[model samples]
Target: MGNRLSKIYTRTGDDGTTGLGDGSRVGKDSARVSAYGTVDEANSCIGLVLASELPDDVRALLVAVQHQLFDLGGELCIPGHAAIFEADIERLEAQLDAFNEPLPPLKDFILPGGGEAAARCHIARTVVRRAERETVNLARHDAVRPEAVRYLNRLSDLLFVLARVLARASGHGEVLWNHERRKA
Candidate 1:
């Protein structure tokens, strides 16, 4: 990792191909690249959520998640690299439970809107789901750690809970879906 990114533009991807962490080149549209690229997109979405006002604990959790996502991206970039582990998934589950414990039980479906920050968290949650799908697709073609997939699965759940927490923290509360609302 020494001086690897000293120069920003390498002009090497002009051919629609990119290099992996193992010095191997593949098409930019390849499954592996798409998988890791989606993970990066999810990370950026989380960063957007972080840019707004948030609870202290939520802020810390998201910051750590950003780093974990970087590791997940690395795991996808390197064919045999093992960045995600069992403990990481366990941590996410524990955090999810802690944040969700005080929340009221959901009897009605909830919409994405809760407030600006909460809405953004919902968007991040969707992107993480997409990343999980992409990673699962990549697994169909190559070796992928089960923990990686499990991590993404658990992360999306954590984000969903966090969105609810943020909504409450911002005093917007949950926006329940109105199934009986008249539609034009």
Candidate 2:
């Protein structure tokens, strides 16, 4: 872990190809690269949400999620690598349930605006959803661990719940969609 990237400006990718964890070079726009890049984007969005003031428990959970996302990215970077597992997916499901338990059930569609932190969380949730879709597309043409896909799926769900929790924590509650507003 010491200076793993001491020389960050490597000219290896000047040919429009990037190196993978296994030392193989692939096009920058390859499916694998796109999948992992989306995962990285999701992690950054989560970081933005973490920058906002949040409850301690929520903060801790998001920190853990960041690490897991990095692992998931690593798993995608290296072919045949297994970083995400059933336990990771299960943990996300448990967190989702715990966070969702105290909130009233949804009666209408959510509009993704509750508070500053909650809005950021919603953004993160959508990015995670994109990551899931990209990973699924990659799986169509290559080998991918089932757990990796499952982890992204559960993580998106957890992010949705977290957004709701953050919204309530910020005293903004949820902004429900008005299906019939246009008729008014």
Candidate 3:
């Protein structure tokens, strides 16, 4: 791990270049930075969902996910570094299985609206998908771990399932998209 930050304003990035953990600086618009920023955005979205009322187990799981996301950010900060572990992905898989087991299978596309917490979770899920796409783009140009990409893909799926679980728990149902009705 890098040294703990003692100051919040380094002013070093005033020129639009940010420093990485490996003492390298890259433009803020670089693919790596974009990937990191998207991940940060997803993390914030998850935080928003966590702010709402949720089951204790789901709350704990999201908390753990936040920590894993921080680890992912740290890994991005250091090129050629492997900070995200397999166990993290495994945990997501386990949670996905547990959460999806009781939920009815999806037969149609769903809209992104429901109870407050569930809706926020859907927003987070989209952000997670964006983060995954950005990470994939970054990996194409940078030396990124394949597991990182795989983890993000899995995480987005987990977030989608979680949103469904949250909706059901809150006495709301899935907002299935009505393509035919809209067309008609």
Candidate 4:
């Protein structure tokens, strides 16, 4: 862990190939790269959400999530590696339960829009779902921990709950979708 990234541009990937943590090189467009890139996108989306003013506890949880996402990315970079652990998934599940406990039962579909931070969280949730899908696809061809996919699935749930929490915290109630009502 001593300056593993001393140089940002290694030029090694200039030829459309990138190095893995296992010292192997693969095409930049490989499934592994795609999976990791999606995870990275989810991470960045969380960062954008974090940029908004949030409660201290929520901020702390999101910060931890960012680190876990990095671990998930590392696991993707090195195929067959289990960088993301069960504890990470458990943490998300705990947060999900905590955040969703107070919300009224969802009897109807909810729109993704809410407060700015909540909207961003929903966007991140969609990215997490995409990442999970890519990870599952990559697993079809290579050895991937089932936990990684499980973690992403749970994370997307957590993000949804967090978005709802944020909207409530910001005094913006959930945007319930009126399925039967036509837009004027």
Candidate 5:
């Protein structure tokens, strides 16, 4: 880490290409970059939710998730390098089960609002979905591991459930979709 960032502006990417962990440069719009970039965006959204009120266990889980996302991004940074472990995906699944156990079963689709924290969670959920799509696209064109895509898929589902949890914490329940209401 001694020489990690001696200079903030390298000026090397003046041509719009960035170096990968493997020391090879590619276009900033490359699939690999897009995959990890969206993951970073989702991570930021999750950070916003973390700044709001959340249960202790939920907070801890999101913190762990942030680390896992970093690992995932790192994996995408280097070709043929793997940073995500099977245990990471398994842990996400376990947390999903624990968080969803108490929520009432959904009978219809729902909107994505219920106060600030819950709304932030909903935003995070959409970003996670976009990250998943980007990862899947990267996998289709690159030699990426299947588990990376799997992790993003599971994370999206977890975010959805966590949004519901946040709504409950705010005593708003879920704002279920009202199809029978007046047309917009």
Candidate 6:
């Protein structure tokens, strides 16, 4: 980990093209770049969730997720390279089960609001889904590790469960959606 970004401004991307981990240049909006960029965006959303008061165990899980997301981004940036694997995806699955086990079963749709931390987790969930979609779009035309997509997909589920957990912990409760019809 030699300060890879010792000089953040390389001026190389000023021409609307950016360098990939393999030293190849592509348009800034290239599908591969967008795919990894969205992962970065999702990681930032998780940062918001981390800044809030939270249960220690949940916070620890999210912190590890941040590191995993960075590895996911690395896998995306460098062609023919991988930093995420099947085990990573399975770890998320285990967390998802552990977190969801205690949550009350859902009978109706829930609004994406509760306590501030839960709301932020909801936001992170949406971003992770978008990252998954972007990765799928990239995969349609290019080679992408299967685990990358699986990671994001599982991450959204984990975030949803974490949100519910945080909401209950905050005593604000889940914001259940109201399906009552209203006359316009």
Say which candidate scores most in TM-score: 2
Write model 2 residue lDDT over 62-146, tens digit each, in one string. 9999999999999999999999889888888998999999989888989899999999999999999999999999999999999
On the 0 to 100 scale, the lDDT of residue 12 in model 2 is 86
- lDDT tens per residue, model 1, 1-184: 5887789999999999999999999999999999999999999999999999999999999999999999999999999999999999999999999999999999999999899999999999999999999999999999999999999999999999999999998999989999888875
lDDT assessment of candidate 2: 0.94
Model 5: per-residue Cα lDDT over 95-175, one tens digit each: 999899988898999799987889999999999899989988998998889889889989989999999999889988788
Minimum summed lDDT over a 10-residue window in model 1 is located at: 1-10
Model 4, range 137-183, lDDT digits (tens) per residue? 99998889999999999999999888889888888878998877886
lDDT of 4: 0.91
Ranking by TM-score: 2, 6, 1, 5, 3, 4
Candidate 2 lDDT at 45 equals 99
Question: lDDT per model, in order?
Answer: 0.96, 0.94, 0.90, 0.91, 0.91, 0.95
Give the runs in model 2 whose Cα sits over 4 Å from its true position.
none
Candidate 1: the clashing residue pairs are: none
Query: Comparing 2 and 6 by TM-score, which wins?
Result: 2
| lDDT at position 33, candidate 4 | 89
Better of 2 and 4 by lDDT: 2
- For model 2, give the 10-residue run with minimal summed lDDT: 1-10
lDDT of 1: 0.96
RMSD of each: 1.3, 0.8, 1.7, 1.5, 1.4, 1.1
lDDT for each residue of candidate 3 in 1-184, tens digit (9 for 90 to 100): 8878878999999999999889999999999999888888999999999999999999999999998888898887799889787887898999999999999888999898779999999999999899899998998888999888888899999999999998888988789988789564
Candidates in order, TM-scores: namely: 0.97, 0.98, 0.95, 0.94, 0.96, 0.97
What is the clash count of model 3? 0
TM-score, cand. 6 vs. native? 0.97
